[model samples]
Target: MKKFLVPLCLFLASMAYSQDDLLNSLDSTQVDGKTPVTAFKALQIVTLQSTKMAAKKEFYFVVSHRFGTVKDGFDSFFGLDNATTKLGGIYGVTDWLSVSLSRHTLNKMYETGLKYRLARQDDHFPVDIVGYSVADINSFLEKDQYPGLEFKHRLTYVQQLLISRKFTEKLSFELVPSFIHKNLYNPDIERDNQFSFGGGGRYKITKRLSVNLEYMHNFDKPDFYKNPLSVGLDIETGGHVFQLIFTNSQAMNESGYVTNAAGDWGKGDFFFGFNLYRVF
Candidate 1:
């Protein structure tokens, strides 16, 4: 028994010495500018869903220029010829929740909104549904005209339902149901403040390139000038997205396009617009 114990103790000591020597050799090699073989490497594993998650916070600013019919010839003098700029930012509070604020330079239209994902598409469910709301403030008009004004006047409210579905790997479409409520309008102009429906579609041509088409129709205004329709192409590169579009609608804001679009597509009055997006 004593002889066997002695041999086992010697073997254990030899193994410990071998490990210590190997560790010391590795340290010396690192210090001497030599690469050492490693049994395992530090690695990061990311799942497809985790890698594809949207950014936590995103900021976007776009300058949109519209060139078409001018309501009055004076517009040409001011270079208001047909130009509007919009600055917007989106903040993702959580993985599935986000909020956005935007201001249109045209007529000082300010909008704040929130978005939440209700359902995500998976192998069992083929559709992705998101809920969104936007509150628009139109600060162009005056409210103290009436002799007996009772309540403080505020701008109109526009609500929209954004529905998106992925039909294929490269194609997706969205349908929007919008409602607009306004208390007053210009006496000379005829407009309706009612619920409306709009729809849009997107087709992905490549990984970072796609085409979008959107149309909005006013159910209350059957005799209104015309519905608004826009078609555009988007190019996404790194942190910038450039959009070039052609549309018959001349209005810059949501309410303007939904209620006061006066341009005609058949008469060759459609205008070309460009949107440049930058992030810092």
Candidate 2:
């Protein structure tokens, strides 16, 4: 009987130790905060990681076509020949900052420009500000001449201040105070070095579609010509953006539009323009 009793007690003690060991292992796992493995959890983690990487970079491209009547009175015999094409690219440097470059070809006229965002909207600032500079070169000007025709070669210089305010997720407005300098214009043609206080807005019609309207008025010389206004629509899909527009100004670049615009909508001159973009 004594032997049996001792064996029983030993068995019970061994079982108790085994149970304690199992509990201790579970407690250690909980304290280390290790999640249990599950198929769904694993997939959720992978999807989250992929989403984070995808948010890092974005790209876009666009091309546009413009046609209108030339206001220089050459259209009577020249057949109202005003047409242009524009190509553009935009890169997302960060979620809030972006840079863009665009090139325009208008018959013999070629122009290019760059835009940069210096500040963005935040809790403290309600408006976003941007700086832009554009230059127009008359390829038609003779380049071989010594000293060259500085006035003719350097067509226009435009510096602009852009202020944009977003009123809602789908609506926003912008104002531009622009200064323009032209070196080639005939001195006899009463002109002003400063031109165009512009304003425009964007209305989002859909998730990937929006319409924009912009206008510029030259306060320095309102009598020089008529104010230039542009209305356009943009379609954004993936890495591509398509812009369709109409305007009284046929010049593609800022310089040409500010200094060389020869169209007057009041006189029945208008143009149709479109842009197509793709990014890799």
Looking at candidate 1, the ten consecutive residues that score lowest on lDDT are 40-49
lDDT per residue for candidate 2 within 1-280, as digits (tens), equals: 3764485466434433432222113112331244211111000010010000011255555455566553445644222355556666656566434455566666355555445656555455566666666666665556574345665545667787777666776676777788888766555664538667766777778865677777777765545566677677765444233466667777666655654455667775666666543443
lDDT of 1 by residue, 1-280 (tens): 3764485466434433332222223212341243322110000000000011123564433345565454344556322455665666666677567666777766677877666766655545555555666566766544455544333234666666555565665565666677777655554555436666766666768755677777877776545467787787766544234567777666555666777666677775565665544432
Model 2 poorest 10 in a row by lDDT: 41-50
Clashes per candidate, residues 3 or more apart or on different chains:
0, 7
Best prediction by TM-score: 1
Q: Which residue ranges in model 1 land beyond 4 Å of their true spot?
A: 1-54, 70-80, 143-152, 186-193
Q: Where does candidate 1 clash, by residue pair? A: none
lDDT of 1 at 115: 68
TM-score against truth, every candidate: 0.67, 0.64
